[model samples]
Target: MNYLKKILVYALPYKRYAILNIIFNILYALFGALSFVVLMPMLNILFGENHDVITEKPVLNGLNNIGGYLKDSLTYSIQTFAENDQLKALTFIIILVIVVFLLKNIFNYMALYFGTFLRNGILKDLRDTLYTKTVNLPISFFSEKRKGDIMSRIASDVNEVQNSFLSVLEIIVREPLSVIFSIAIMLTISVKLTLFVFVFIPTAGYIISVIAKRLRQQSADVQKEQGIFLSILEETLNGLKIIKGFNAQSLFNSKFTDSTKRFFNFSNKMMNRQNIATPLSEFLGIVTIAFLLWFGGRMVLIDKSLLASSFIAFMGLAYNILTPIKALSKANNNVKRGNAAAERVLEIIETTNPLEDIPNAISKTNFKTSIDINSISFKYEDDLVLKNFSLKVLKGKSVALVGQSGSGKSTIANLVTRFYDVNDGSITLDGDNIKSLTKHSLRNLMGLVTQDSILFNDSIKNNILLGKENATDKEIIDALKIANAWEFVKDLPREIETNIGDSGNKLSGGQKQRLSIARAVLKNPPIMILDEATSALDTESERLVQEALENMMKNRTSIIIAHRLSTIQNADLIVVMQKGEIAEQGTHAELILKNGVYKKLVDMQSFE
Candidate 1:
């Protein structure tokens, strides 16, 4: 019930539809009971043994006013029909039964009509809210979680909320109303028999409740198992090349099969529990009805206190109550399962994003003066990556950072981009603290070209345009020509429209690197950061791409994290780092003359 309260808030926007459905259900329930009441009069006329006292004036109880009105109207209509033929009276009763049945169905249709809008409305809101929350969550939230697990919450879990639980709203309004109205009719006919129904219903309800408790735990387990297999599938697709290279297909297949096998076992348990509720409740309800028939028959024959026709109508109404009760029991279990799914979805929705921008944060649109790294000490955990590191780059100057693999080159780039916040000290741009600037504005002023050629499965033209959304076709062509990518792009069957396939797989190692260069070239930002942009390429590709980088660096402020000493030979200042601190800093030629860490690295590369 607590879970239901939280989920019901998603339906608040469609209150009008919910109310209309309830109104229609109430009418359907009333008409359904009245239809069985009509049969009592017919049975009395056909089967009552004592016919001598039939001339007594009719006495209506609960429905006296309605009965009077209907009696007067039917009497007039019967008189008119009798003038034409004696058989018209039988025809009128048959027509009355048809009209009552029609009304019952009409309201039933109305209930379903409004229910469609209510159910669909909840589904749309739930999915939209889940997606909105996912985009707002912190990067750390995803770094520690699988993409497939998040996707499952959005796709399958939200779907379960709609399919399994939304129907509970219909049962809450429609079925229970139906059961109550039918029980009232049964009580009016024979209070003693109605008491027997009450005794049997609670016992069946208790059994169903016990089964439902296990459903929530089992349902949660099934959804979790589904996420595990989805994660394996996503991982396999992303790493297919590595798996094939290592011949690890059989290992992955077994892992995926194991996850799915667990899903099957848990699903079987949940279904078995859900399927048992319906039949068990029905069988118990039938037994109660059978007992009522025997008891009611004895009262009519032996005590002479009950009428035969009312007893027959009473039995029908009692049995009708059982259908709704049994349906409610089934809906209860569905609600439990759905509650488990809703809980998982809400967990993501309620997560707080740790990287959100502050209220009234200012935006930085231009750069002037210099970018200053001031006493910036940082660490991933206890092992410091940058220890009291500081540097300054004036506008339009180029500085290159050259170091071994563990010397914090990439970590410095990551901090400058604000992919993470510093644990200590401050990084300021043009005399303003970077943290005060909007994240979008800070990134907008700079462009990045990484070691890995991160191109999407898209056309060469589309991939380049990502650098600048509204860049003209002439500008894109010019950028490609600068990066020396135009030669290959023009040779493709469709030119710029030609598909690059996954991660630009159709291109050679050098071609992919040039495309990445073209993407950064088109951005044309005031600041540029190159993280070994041409390190992973053949000699020919390196020579061609190197010329493009030097051309891009002309009159632009840049921070280059380079591994190949040849790439940074012309850097205005070369900072050699060791153990997260600057070990040497000077011009490339000055560093080699010093014969420090920089000279050793240059000599090592010279030998290779």
Candidate 2:
């Protein structure tokens, strides 16, 4: 319930709609009860029972006897207006009932109408907030979480919260007020009968609550299993090629089937518990009515204390009370189910990001002098990946880091991009600590071209525009030409306007790499970081991408991390890394002459 209250904060901007819905619901409940009570005189006239011949209106002596006064006043009005005409009296009563019923329905529709805005508005705002949070969270947050599970919280769980929030509104406002108005009218008709009605209420509520209490955990299990199968589906779709190649369709299918079995069982148990609500409430209501008939019938027939018409109308009002009570019991169960979803949705929205920009952080727009990494230490787990390692990249110089796998070459790229901050020590740009600068401005100083050639499903112009949002067609063509990609791009169907498929899969690996370089070339940052950008291409493709990288690297502070030793042979300095620390650093020719760790790496690549 607290989590639901937290979720309601999204409804603040649409508070006017919520307020209107509540006002209309109050009117709906008031008239809904009055519609049943107004029929007492009509029943009396139809059956020729409880008719009073009064010519004068009764005075309300005090607030306590207003019920008696109202009842008497209704009798006096009928007698005077009828003037001994039976059909005319009946006609007036029917018209009165229609008026009350009409108002009730109109209010009910108005309540639903305003509520539509509140419900959908909160839903849209909540999902939008969840997506923004997902994107703004640090890179390490996604590494430890499943993409499919996050998608479930954003899509499925937020929808559940929207539905449950509506239930909360009914449970707190509309349903209870309907019951209260009905019960208040019941008391005016007969206090003893209404008191008897109270005895059965707490018992019925307790039984319904017992069933609802067990529904929440079961609902949570169903939602969790839903996320699991969705993860399996996402994985299967992403790796469909490899799965089909290995003939492992049955394995993934088994995983999906097993998850659905658990989901099926969980859903059955939860719905079974939830389904008991209506029938159980109906049964209890009938039982209460049966007792009232016996007790109320005795007062009319044997004791002569209550009228026949009053008893019948009292019965109608009691049944009206049961209607809202039944809805209330069902609504209670809904709140419990929605509470689970609210917890999941709010969990992501409320997550504390440790990598958020510091208070009063400066925004650095330009890079000069050098980037100094002073004895930084970091670890993804218990084992350190970079231990007290330090290096300095001066302006307009290219430094290549050559290392084997697991030697932390890529970690340097991640740290330099500020995807994850160093656990100890600091990285500075031109003597200003990177942490003291806002992330947006800090990242604006560099361009990155990674191993995967990350691109979106958009036109080539749009993809390049990601680097410079306001860049022109001339700028895009110049960048493509500089990266040596314009030669192939010009022969395409739409050239710069061509639509690349998902993740740029429409282009070959070399073409994708060259496009990535073109994107970075458009940005024209002071510093460039290329993380094995040409590692996966064929020989001819590698030569073309290498030439593009060489062109882009000139006059920029570039850090090139490479697995192939041939790529870094012409770099100003090649630093050989054995573990987390540097093993050797020198010019390629100088390191070859020394016959040290650099020579060993070059010899291995040559032997292969």
* Candidate number of the best lDDT: 2
Cα lDDT computed for each candidate against the true fold:
0.83, 0.90
Residues 1-608, model 2: lDDT tens digits: 88899988899999999999999999999998898778988888877875557767799899778678878888788878888588988898899999999999999999999988998999999999999999999999988887888888888888988888778889989999998998888888889888988888888888888888888899889888888888899899888989999999999999999999999999999999999989998999899899889999999999998878888988988888889888888888888888998988888899999889999999998998999999998898889998888999999989999888999899999999899999999999999999899989988999999999999999999999988999999999999999999999999999999999988989999999999999999999999999999899998999899999999998999999998777887888788886788898988899999998888888888933
Give the candidate number with the greatest TM-score. 2
RMSD (Å) of each candidate, 1 decimal: 3.6, 1.6
Stretches of model 1 off by over 4 angstroms after superposition: 1-4, 45-90
Worst 10 residues of 2 by lDDT: 46-55
Instruction: Report the error of model 1 at residue 319, Å.
Output: 3.0
RMSD of 1: 3.6
Instruction: Report the C-alpha lDDT of model 1 over 154-264, residue by residue, as the tens digit.
Output: 888888887764457647777788888888777666677778778877887787788777898999999988888999999999899999999999999999999999999
